[model samples]
Target: MSSSKTIVLRSSDGETFVVDEVVAVESQTIKHMIEDGCADTSIPLPNVTSKILSKVIEYCKKHVETPNSDERSLKRILNPLILTL
Candidate 1:
C-alpha cells in the first residue's frame, strides 16, 4: 500500500517523510499539480520544518477522517458574547 501512491518529502534537517497522495493533496499547490498529472515525482517542502510539517500532516489526517467538532464546540463554548453600550 505504501509503494503505489506515496511520495518522499525531504525536510531541511534531512528528515524524510513518506506521505500518501491523498494526504499531500491538502496543499493547494500539490492538489493542482496532482490534478494536472504532474506529481509523479517526490515533492520537496523546503520552507516547512520537519516538526511543523509533521504536525500539519497530523492535523490533516485527523480532519480528513473526522470533522473538527471539538474545535467548533470550544469556540462556541468559550467565546463570550459581550454587549457594548
Candidate 2:
C-alpha cells in the first residue's frame, strides 16, 4: 500500500533510515508533525540512537500488522526490547 511514499529518518549517529511514510508516521509526534505540514523532508531524531530506532521501527511494524494483539503478548514480546534498553 505504501508504494511510492517514504520518509527519511536521520538518527543521532548519522545513520539514515528510509522508511515507508505510513510506518514512519506511527509515532504520535511524527503524526502531529505530518498533520501540521512540518515534516516534509528528512526527520531528525537527535536523541535516539540507531540501535534504539531500529528496534522501535521493528516494534511498530509488528504492532501495525497485529492491531488487536493482546497486551500480555505484547508485553512478552516487548520485554526483550525493554531489557536491551
Winner by lDDT: 2
lDDT of 2 by residue, 1-85 (tens): 4547887887899998888777777788766767787766878889989998898887777777777889898997799888888
Model 2 is weakest, by summed lDDT over 10 consecutive residues, at 1-10
Candidate 1's displacement at residue 14, Å, is 2.3
Clashes of 1: 0
In order of appearance, the predictions have TM-scores of 0.62, 0.82
Please state the error at residue 53 of candidate 1 in Å: 0.7
What's the distance in Å from true for residue 10, model 2? 0.9
- Which residue pairs in model 2 clash with each other? none
Give residue 36's error in model 2 in angstroms.
Answer: 2.4
**Residue-level lDDT tens digits of model 1 in 44-66:** 66787787677666655554555
Evaluate residue 68 in candidate 2 and report its C-alpha lDDT on the 0 to 100 scale.
87
Stretch of 10 with least lDDT, candidate 1: 76-85
lDDT of 1 at 72: 81
